[model samples]
Target: MTLSKAFYLLSPRNFALKSKIPLRSFARGYANSEVLRKTPLYDFHVENGAKMVPFAGYSMPLTYGNVGQVASHHHVRTKAGLFDVSHMVQSNFRGKTATEFLEWLTPSSLSSLKPYSSTLSVLLNEDGGIIDDTIITKHAVDAFYVVTNAGCRDGDLAWIKQKLHEWNSGQGKEGPVEHEVLEDWGLVALQGPEAASYLQSLTSFDLRQLTFGTSAFVPIEGGFNVHIARGGYTGEDGFEISIKPLQTVEVTELLTKVPVQLTGLGARDSLRLEAGMCLYGNDLDETTTPVEAGLSWVIGKERKELGGFIGAETVLKQLKEGPKRRRVGLVVEGAPARQGAKIVEPTTKEELGVITSGIPSPTTGKNIAMGYIKNGHHKKGTQVAVEVRKQLRPATLTPLPFVKANYYRG
Candidate 1:
């Protein structure tokens, strides 16, 4: 996947261009002022007593009053929890050169990925900054499944479409690829230590055989089959089920009919923070890069060598010679340092970084934060200072996920 080859592959993908546009946003809601986009499960969330909030131009559930955030987090840690992730954007790409097409947008070596296997990848800007972080799954050499953040929907779709028109009309090209947007779809995540047991009860398909980071279609009651993906934002054994919008409510009721408790965004945010995962707008935007974010691991080795994908020149240079600043974990003292909390050197009070995400860990009973600091101060155990309420608070750069992951490899 070299630069020229990558540009060659990025030329044919579909985008939903005719969707309605927002003249105003719900961030400041008022009658006729603005309205947010709603997921397919919007009414379902209301029926389940969800505390909805405006997020990423969509009306989404923040938390449920019946289940406190801490309890919900713990429940998901010990047992399965259900979430309506219908806000995420899902799309499909299929053509004789689909694999080659996707390699141009992301740095992962998609051509070599096994069927039904997925890899976390980044969509880099030309300057080596992250445009968006993405997950790409290969169903066949001629096809792929791509999931990107909703926050970047407009920009991502526009970029993909612009690239498509160019790719299709380019000189000596293979022509357009078949692409589909699974719009108005439903996505549900069932995660925890007991997730496998809970999901296994629904089908004769022995889920124990499904390894982590994989996906397959699985049958459930009501004759509904779903693309069950064996991965989640929480660092626990889980499955992300992709379903049709029409069947979301019924499917959710069926899944939660078991021991699984209904969870919301509050618990989801805390769980992800505890896992040291990045939240799109908070932790990353158009300015972050895989290398600077300690995600160089996501870039394929061949991609590094071949200089494929956008921003390859800068990413490769940074990869060859490490980035000046790097994302890392910190175990801070005193109160929790939430987003934008400044990180500084303890002795000199010189600013180092700012907390991108943080939480008072219910499982660990510690204040944990994740952020980027100057490369030299990123080593484990390095003491740092965080500015909380204008006062310097002592903190240390500890290893990530203050609590260890409990993923079931099998």
Candidate 2:
């Protein structure tokens, strides 16, 4: 099977509810074991007794010894947590046509983006289905920095390279866009309510100046120069620091000192889910589109009016009309409705959709979930039922972000 097919098969869509397997295990199982990779902090994770597991083709930490997943989850919500996200693919796109090139690839309008501002965007296929979600940072009019999920590294790299070649040689007046993959970098996310204060102690550059969705190269303690982005997947006030591979361990060590818990993938999954973020393999795939995935905001207003990006036809149609189904939040009444659990009408028993991601939230102590539901039933407060195991649990459509996000916009 192709890698995409293999991933789709391993995804939660095919999971059996009775197995009651830990979701983390199911997520890890998606990684190909025959050719596993390691992040720069692999040794650091080992020394910390992190329970390493396969993820996105890398052997990554699941949780540290004696620190349970729920504990780590709560720590990040209350105080702070540090996560190693170095496996993600980071790249630089430069040249006079960089802005135009990126605009053609994704729906975001890069021209109006001020320097250091970043926007979440998606790479779409010809059918408008999402290839992968990414963060694009406009460093300058001629330069852009991008970070994509580790699980999509190979596919994203290939797609960008092919498109770059075409855009470079195609009918355009600007200089060719240059692509530079930054494979020698290590990324660490410092998250939670106390993240800014903790990070502020290590840098003379005012952490306050770097508001949410903005990035800047700053020197930290130990003279380590790194690109610090003031935002994270966890819907909390946080910083994602990109450092040189050789300095990864030192940077992590400095950040994980007391009050800042060392977190792993297990907690990270729950955190992002609770924060209403999508996990590529489970919550998003090649068949999903930004509009259906509730990510239409990524498309610029101008782009929507004068469509130019790939799959603009389908996307704009969905934007003008509405998607048949939409990604929405849910609150299950009983037994957490995990991925693959069917959503149906209570009395008619008509199937509406299936759950994509769900859990007994560690932060809220409630069964919360996210799934795509038929458009008419996606409105908040809509009543539905989730078939968990052999029984149906009552559920209510809730607005996304089970918890309010606390981003540092200032």
Candidate 3:
């Protein structure tokens, strides 16, 4: 659904993919119950004993009946877990200049991307600030599939549509880019160590060949065809299956039949946090640039030199001169530092930045956080203090991805 439709249908609890923003913010923005919306799997969630919560305008599952958040988190790490991510905005861009259009939007090198390959990218504004973080998958020269955060639905769509119009109307444009929003599509993320083995039994498309960052259209039992991508937000080996709205429920039921645990947003948050992934509204905002977020690797080396994309001047400048502040991973000594927690120097308590995301890592048994800190203080082993609960907690800057990622590259 378009963000406006979703927001108006949404309720006070606020169901969304990116909710690192304080709950008070949501209360102020969308407190009315009439605006709450639901995904196609709303009935399925209710039937499965999901604890309904308002998020990003949808009534989403926070956790199933008796299953605790920690259990679900561990289950996904050791076995398999099913996550309903249908609230995310999915779209397709097609046209002769589609590649160029995408290149112009982000700093990534889409021209060199192989078919069926995907890469994490960011949409930037004219000032080189990030509009939203996105996953762009190249299906063909003219066909591209993109998945953006649910919370960014409104802004992302508007920016993309406006850019498409401008690109099409430009005098020297080779061809216009066509934008298609796939509203209410079903996106199921099957994650964990056993994901491949479970999926292999239902599909004959050689799951082994579908390595990380790749995707293919495969036929499953009951003659159902779906688009499956080999990557997930969690640090586990997994697949994200994209199905038509009509077949989503059936496909989800079939996939969750045996070993897959029904996971909810509670676990999803901790999982992505441990995986070192950034949530749009929290770790990323329009004022933040990819370089400052430690996402310089997403920029292509050639693209860096050519400087073609929007906000290239600022991004390139940051790459060359270095960002003033850098996002860093930290291990807190006591009490979990949450969003908005101030990051300060140890002795002087000089504020460097603030924590964008933080949680007690289910895997590491330690309080972990990701935040922006002054460049020199971002190195590992550096000492810092996080203001948690009005007290300064000892923190040490550390490497990101608290848990090692396990993507099936082979």
- Report model 1's TM-score to 2 decimal places: 0.90
Q: After superposition, how far is residue 282 of candidate 3 from its true place, in Å?
A: 0.6
Candidate 2 positional error at 193, Å: 1.1
Alpha-carbon deviation at 317 in model 2, angstroms: 0.5
RMSD of each: 10.3, 4.8, 4.6
Predictions in order: lDDT: 0.79, 0.87, 0.87
* Model 3: CA > 4 A from native: 1-34
Please provide the root mean square deviation of candidate 1 (C-alpha atoms, Å). Answer: 10.3
Query: What TM-score would candidate 3 get against the native?
Result: 0.93
Per-candidate TM-scores read: 0.90, 0.93, 0.93
Weakest 10 consecutive residues of candidate 1 by summed lDDT: 14-23
Q: Which residue pairs in model 2 clash with each other?
A: none
Q: Which of the two, 1 or 2, has more TM-score?
A: 2
> Tens-digit lDDT track for model 2 on 244-269?
86898998899998799889887888
